[model samples]
Target: MTAVTDQDHTDQAGDAGSENREGPVEEPVGGDADRGGKDGHTRVESAKGGPARAEAGPGRARAEAGPARGETVENAEGQADADSAGGWDDGLIARRVTAETEQAAAVEVRGPNAPPAAPLAYDAPLHSRLDALRELVGLSRARLDSRTLAEAGQVLDEAAARRRLSGQHTVVAIAGATGSGKSQLFNALAGVAISETGVRRPTTAAPIACSWSDGSASLIERLGIPPRLRRRPLQSAESEAQLRGLVLVDLPDHDSAAVQHREHVDRILALVDAVIWVVDPEKYADAMLHERYLRPMAGHAEVMFVVLNQIDRLPGEAAEQVLDDLRRLLDEDGIALGEYGESGATVLALSALTGDGIGELREALGQFVAERGAPARRIAADVDAAAWRLRPVYATGRRTGLSEEARDDFAARLADAVGATAAGEAAERAWLRNANRACGTPWLRLWRWYQDRREPPTGRLPLRAHPEEEATARQRVEQAVRTLADRASAGLPAPWAQAVREAAVRGSQGLPEALDELTARAGLPPGRPPRPGWWPAAVLAQASMTLLQIVGGLWLVGQIVGVMAPNLGVPVLLMVAGIIGGPLVEWSCRMAARGPARRYGVEAERRLREAASGCGRARVLDPVAAELLRYREVREQYSRVVGV
Candidate 1:
């Protein structure tokens, strides 16, 4: 039933003197003064926490807009409100100076765009979830494309930041369509014309804010309000004494024809702690208001309020009917009431012009201010909204890494390209070739030695000797990696799928060279057949045969010349037996070499396959698999964020 405005200095000073004779009296609310308010309600006394004033004494305390260093505002009970706030004053923008008294603290005009003071209260689980999200962002930023849920991520970041700045300042944005008496309601609450009101269409082009305390400079600045829009030459008024810790903002009309005005409303809606939707009898259930703002915000019902302003125009019975109709529309729009949705919105009826029903509105605000739970509830709702946006990425069941069958197929493809099978064959051939020389007839061994000394080392075997073949092998390795990535990301959301693709080839930029190098180092083992433990015995037997041949040849020559006994039949017989024994010993050694050759070939194939698989794992599959794990981990964290 009152409005604070320009007051003469003489009257204000005289009133201040009279008020000092009678100090502030704390009345007993509950029957027992000791309990304060036992009915679950607290009568919040307006505590002093603004810029420092002279120590409370018998007369009015001297006023200052911004206190000097180390000045603290202590209440009559010696309880502290803001002790460590001198740092915020340095960042404060131009605020209008004001006067004050000992009973009522001087309320100064804060810089419209000043930063916030003091962070939100301690929340353990909240901090844990925050830490988990930071980890997800850091680990997956480079690995995944982070576009689809960008808004959600941004909301989380800003929310955490705002809470860090100041939890005590509850930013309640009053929003409504044109001709909704929105600005009038704001002025009525603030007890001053802080927001412009008139017959002009789409007035209040920008948001206007009026706070009850002085420590929320940073929060005001963060809302993007400019300094020019704030009220000037502020004063301490008695009408605003009941509501402290409240920062009321009059936002631009949501249904304005001006696009910038609508944009402003939309932007501020995302940052506020609570929302008050102002409507009048004329457009109480306007479809534009309900569809554009209310229905879309169904999940934020807990922090919402529907004010049916200009009710004085309706007759008592008509007002009831209109109020009922408005309730139906709110139900349709899903906007709830009460500080925490204790019941259906008690659709408040008021007349900003007539000043009727204003007391009830003030009481509702007083309770909201006293409870101090709206900020927390509003923040919680914001998280819920953000979580809803990310449901598509996390709602489905978790996806694991590349399956076993796929990995094996991929490895097999790379092994073929690396010429592991070719190396195995070369090993077999080389073992057999050496065995031929080791066990061949002693006389023919001389011809084999001549051939071995002439061939180049590479031409000696058919083991991946072409550059064209090596290039093809590299391509095959890269392709296998791509296939695995595509299969793993199938059916996932686009961002996650894109992330998988990026991760799949993350380390593959150097894959071609890497594969070529790996293949080059996987050379076949030595071509010589390993000399068996019994090689000496076999060689000795062959040498003995050779000696017999030599001796026989000499004897035969002597007999033919008739120089010695011509009937020496034993010499011819010894030469024929030695020739037959040499072939028999050579055949046995070649047979024994077959088993060793097969074993050596198998070993060569294994070594090449191992080397090729190592390259595939490093350049392709590992990054993709890491991205999949990150997805699963973030999905788990999203569930925790929603408190599901």
Candidate 2:
């Protein structure tokens, strides 16, 4: 923010820049500084501090200041210079006019070196962002692989810690390969001697933190920066006030020979809210940088900055060419460019040693600090990255459960294997046995009783299913479950499909025994239907017929003996009636048993089948159903995690 007084012109940018720096920040970092050859062109990749050294290029040091490369930066610098002139005094005409001429302000936001600053962040709040990250981690644990789960958990913890300790503070880390002058860039950005900058092979063994406010102590501690290396905000001048609440971290070199140094860089890279990757012109196109870090962090483009440090070495056109090439590499890395770009990776050119682009970098950082959305954006990016990592877990879409027809077929197969039909037949036969005892003709029933005495049927069901059937029943049940699992997990990922299969078999272990037990306890249909009124009549007629026969026999005997009056005609008629009625009544009772017995057989079979079905459902279908339910739950969880 620039202070404005009665003077029509305001020098807000100058005021901020002046407080931070009296002149450009300068320091020497270890490495060959030759950046180009005769044509002022150098290969995209220049080996730095290595055995192979390239010859020096013409005017390499100041070549980048040529017209072509300085087109944009020079214009900015020129405007700032013009703005720094004594004062703006325009002739005033005191007259009423419909329109007034006004000149637009050419705000020199950054110095000649850094790129233009971007707009403030437009993301959710820090807590919400961290909360979202935690939610993603929880979901991943249930539905994703171990690697994804661990990554999400780590990100969640780090993000929460950073947010808890630093309220509305932006943590911008300076990361680069060895000899990239990353430390120098860090110090330049702070406009103070905060980080150790030297020509040593590995100058920074540990991360150095420079804060612009006292609020960052806890934040720096959370970031794992030792208190010894921690520097308080520079309050000696008012310029640094613009950078208050900013925590600038100088990380160990990513390409350091020491494994510990590289590990430190990796650890710090993950925790920082934002990162400014310092790339020297020599190693600008290093594959290790792009492949290992930039490509993987494509989702975090918004909070990333790719700075081409030491641009002072390239000719004007050569510098432009290098920047263009760097942009190409970053694009290949899938990193985006600006807030307005589809991605969020900001690209710029600067020389930390010369401080040519330090003002621009500072301006950009100032805007970033002012935005106060770095934490939110960073956490959001992490969540997105986590989601992408677990993409394969849910690549396949959700499929509904097995069809009703398929299930019925499976059930029918199970019933057959369980001997449901056999049980029903036995029940029907049992019903018939009872029916006959209740309604059969008395004489014939006595005959049946005598026959049963010769060979009585066992009390146990005559139609009982054989125990040998248990094997076939178990096999059929297992097959049915397997089929159901296959269909349910058709398009699912391998792990989830395997889960469904395991779930299907969970209830199948003791199934055969259970079915056997069920069959053993299966109830047969009860017998003894209510007797009809005609049964009693029939019995009485049969008894009376017998008495009539006896009378005929006695009459005939008396006639022959001449002891009483002879009655041949009446006796004959009675005898004929008794014989015919007896036979007819017996026949009628036998015929009545036919229809009732048939019906009883059908009803008994139905009951037996029902019992068999119950066993099949509990032992077979129940387990399969459980698996399907689990599948549905997991599918829903993945859907939530991926937002699909």
Candidate 3:
């Protein structure tokens, strides 16, 4: 292989001059000695140069006619290798579009010195795009409508199968309705009658392939063609050499009366790299072809050719009129015609019997075959169509992620559902009741105990919910989940939104019970909070006051029985002081207990609320967040696929 240098690019550009070129043609493969002259990178002997270099001539100019190629081939060490330049990335879409667009315009129309065509590359590589589509489909399969994604899946499967086969051979299928002379045209293109053709309504019952070169067996087999049905060109050496690397398939009549024949046509058409629709003047505007296939496959203009075959039946300009009318119909069907050499659907007129316009068709096909880009172009178009179909699901009005406020609201709801606040209030009341029992006046305490003895004893403070509170708690939990789902799914597509909703619902099951369990295990202080030392002192003081009261009462009884001398009412004063002081001590203890009771209640509430929030996050918010994360990942993949 010869080393391509900067001069070679310049020479190629100079040769291109001011005219655009058609499809790119690959440089002929040869040994190093055959490629390089005396110089390492030169093809022709130069007087000023050290070695001979290749020059771009009229015939060889088309091979290098695209935009000055900016892309390079690299070796394992990441260095550019001119020897491998023609192998990798040859039949890619960017190159094809550049070549076709240049060929479509004139130098006069597109300025004389129009800058070299801008490099066009896939937004993402083909494999990456396909992988994105596969993952998107897998994730969305259960959530989305199956019918909507079926086309994308089919595109993925077909692309994989086609890419696995031979990249050297371009498979072109000749498809047409019955009695449309498609078989005749197929035989005409192959330069031999390899496919059977007759006056029968469906002459071609099965597809037959004719290859112009070797190494296409896998491709033929992929099309489901049996060995017996596959044939070679069997034409003159020159004819075979001209159409090298082309695998022409003659498909069954698409409009055949036989269901199997029509099925065969449709099946083969989908797998073929390019399709040549051979229509006669009579059925050129057939509704079946336009409605069913052409309109639906409008995006595949790069790999489509609409041939008005059998134009010999029409007189002089009638054929031209029909061709113009056909172009109009194709436009209406949304197929872009490759007018003025543009890179789009190629439409032409020809007759297999008369041989008129046959040379022009052959010339165009030769350019197409020489390029070996039809398969890549077809696959790229399929990807574009699939991506377009999937646009709605991926395109969002705004971000639909879970919000912080929403999470906080959910946690609060769960806390309420488990009755954390109510439990705290109960704790405060329990502390107050215990304090009153321990420090109240002795006689009063006795009287209260005797009064409560008649009623059943309540074992423990009521920390859990009553039956009615339990029902209310359940409702609160359900509402929290519902609100979270609504917030998370806002502005999302129907499928993704529904998936988020389902995720929230799935994680919410058993959540209320789980929160209740968490509250129970919240490690709250069990009975009355740890007693303060001052509580004991208060209790002793109350006992002393009670003693004083008893002493004063005994003395009064003695005086009444006349067992003692006259007193100055000391017993009465002592009784009055004891009575006032005891009530005052009890009131002081009650006031002091308020601070500790409030602190203890707050601690209990904190523990319960913390546990409830953590539970809610694990059971509900975490799952919802996971789902949202998945959506974000898939959205990024979708952007890569769409080249956003």
Using TM-score, give the best candidate's number: 2
RMSD of each: 11.2, 16.6, 15.3
The lDDT for every candidate, in the order shown, is 0.64, 0.60, 0.70
What tens digits encode model 3's per-residue C-alpha lDDT throughout 1-644? 12122223334435545232421111111112212223222122222112233443333332232233322111111222233322443221111111111111101111122223221122247778778888888877766788988988998888877766777678999999878888778767755444556665667767877776556667877888754455554335566667877888888888888898888888888888899999998899999999988998999998999999999899979998999999999999989999887889999999987678778888888789888788878888888888888888877979789888988888888888887787787777667767877889987788878976995342234455378877888899999999999999998877788888998999899998888777778845555566777998999999888888888877888888888765839888778778987888889999999998888778778888899989888878888888788889878878877767
Candidate 3 global lDDT: 0.70
Give the TM-scores of the predictions, in the order they appear: 0.65, 0.66, 0.66
Query: Would you list the rank order by TM-score, best first?
Result: 2, 3, 1
Ranking by lDDT: 3, 1, 2
- Candidate 1: which stretches are off by over 4 Å? 1-119, 134-161, 164-169, 181-244, 258-264, 280-287, 308-367, 386-400, 403-408, 443-462, 466-471, 484-510, 525-529, 537-584, 616-644
Query: Which segments of candidate 2 are over 4 A away from where they belong?
Result: 1-148, 232-238, 339-343, 391-395, 400-410, 429-467, 484-496, 525-631, 634-638
Once fitted onto the true fold, the runs of candidate 3 whose alpha carbons sit more than 4 angstroms away are 1-124, 134-157, 196-198, 234-242, 311-325, 339-343, 384-401, 431-460, 463-468, 479-509, 530-599, 627-644
Give me the displacement of residue 511 in model 2, in angstroms.
2.0
Please give, for residues 1-644, the per-residue lDDT of candidate 1 as tens digits: 01111121112223334222121111111111111222221111123444323332344433222233222221111112232222322211222222232222222222223344667763676656556555555555664457845765786677677777676667788998898898888867765444666677777777866666546555666787643333211233433456666777789889889898899999989888778889989998788888888888877776677788988888868988998888778877776654355743446888887778877887877677667767666666666776677677656655545788888887788788777888788877787777777677777789877876897542135445588876777777678777877787876667778888887777667776775677667756434546667677777877777778888888899899988798668898878877887888788877877888889778878887888788878777787777777777777777777775
- The TM-score between candidate 2 and the true structure equals 0.66
